[model samples]
Target: MKCPKCGKWSLMKFYICKNCGYKIDIKFEELVKRLTSENDDIFVSGMRDACSYTHSNKFYGVYAMEEAIKRKAKSENIDFYEPGFTYRSGIEYAEARSELLSLARKKGFLADVHLTQELISIWLAMYTHLDFNDLAEEIIEISKGLDEIHNFQLLYNQMHDTAVLNNNDVQRE
Candidate 1:
């Protein structure tokens, strides 16, 4: 969630904004409603909330993510809960997909998510095909040129491995 006072992102588990020390009493359900709301502005607000919350943890974050996907489906006039309803091609769907993938990527990096090089390659490929900037301001809040990125690696080998995997993916393609 964002610090209402400073407008900076913060983890939902935190009641005080780290940047401005503003008290945050927003309810989780309220965030979810905004996420699933029909209003675009409200949806973006909810996306920012989900993005920050997912940054630190994936417990309730999953629900927030589900709501996003469901909203995307609704936008495309598809029933997300329908049996075997997978993905659809649409502007809103693509936007939501990219945002969700960015969130997953950030969550993976933050939580030491591990996969075979093959999987990582697939992930990188998908990410490359989509616009990373689509919902970046609201979703993945990457701190460019900061040690926060380099230091968040849970394991030293994981960081190096990710670099190697990216190189391999480039060479293979």
Candidate 2:
């Protein structure tokens, strides 16, 4: 079941959420697994949160992304019922997707994450503004592990593109 507190799916035996501790007396991890195995609304919720958080975090990229997504969706004649994706669009989704992943990234979620070419491209686009040195050690570790652990060769290759991932881009690490 969706944890009322953290909104994550939990194992039937798991009374506490790993992401955010929320205990429900109900034994329901199996149900959570079954539904989330296919899909879940939490992804959508996180998407919306990403948009709002990005807008609040300060910058216009998310806003611009929002417009771009809206235009693309419209051009493609893809109708969206959810406001989070359609209303917020690019900026918010990007921001939310990344931001929601911040903790996961820090905790090496990318290792467990199914890395794809699309994901690498998105990170490259979003983090092109980021410098290699500015990256957290954990982030660096994850980057390196992308190939070693996950065998994400596409991601590994793109990560070497100095134009986007570099040491001098942000003046931090």
Candidate 3:
């Protein structure tokens, strides 16, 4: 089995992520049982738990959850939207991330200082993660250093330069 938290392969018997110690003991049988449950709370809880396990692109639980969602909606005679994460190839993921960052930059450019700060906060949250610890720390420090509204322009300039560089890099690739 793959550990949903760390994307590492682990023996099924271990029920743990070898790299991050995240619990991977999702009981498949129990999850299926809950899907068939009549109680709304139990079924909904199962679905929510299933969504969390979707970080592992290879995990079967995501498909099971999708099927369960479809079955439930059909039986209940309603339209439905599946509520779990979708797996994307590396290139697709990169493109989506780039688009999102571009949108944020454009919006921040037109926004007031308060809105710009909010946008920056959201961008940092989405961009910074464990894999980029040093980069994340540097970004956080830069954001913090921009204490005055006047300094916001500096941040915007840096973001624009980054976007230009990212575009060049992508083109080269």
> Best-fitting candidate, measured by lDDT?
3
- C-alpha local distance difference test of each model: 0.42, 0.35, 0.43
Error of 1 at 34 (Å): 0.6
Model 1 gets an lDDT of: 0.42
Query: Across residues 44-132, which tens digit of lDDT does each residue of candidate 1 receive?
Result: 56556655544443334335444333343333232211112244445444454444445345543233232322223333344642443
Inter-residue clash pairs, candidate 3 = none
Worst 10-residue lDDT window, candidate 3: 145-154
Off by over 4 Å in 1: 1-26, 68-173
lDDT of 2 by residue, 15-44 (tens): 666667766644233322222221335423
* Candidate numbers sorted by TM-score from highest down: 1, 3, 2
User: What C-alpha lDDT, on a 0 to 100 scale, does residue 172 get in candidate 2?
Assistant: 15
Estimate candidate 2's RMSD in Å: 18.4
Identify the superior model by TM-score, candidate 1 or candidate 3: 1
State the displacement of the C-alpha of residue 155, model 2, in Å, after optimal TM-score superposition.
Answer: 2.5
Q: How close is every model to the real structure, measured as TM-score?
A: 0.30, 0.23, 0.25
lDDT of 3 by residue, 1-173 (tens): 66654558776555766677787546764675565465657755755565444433223444444334334333323222212234445555455434434433443322343334334434444465563354334433544421221223223332333344344442211
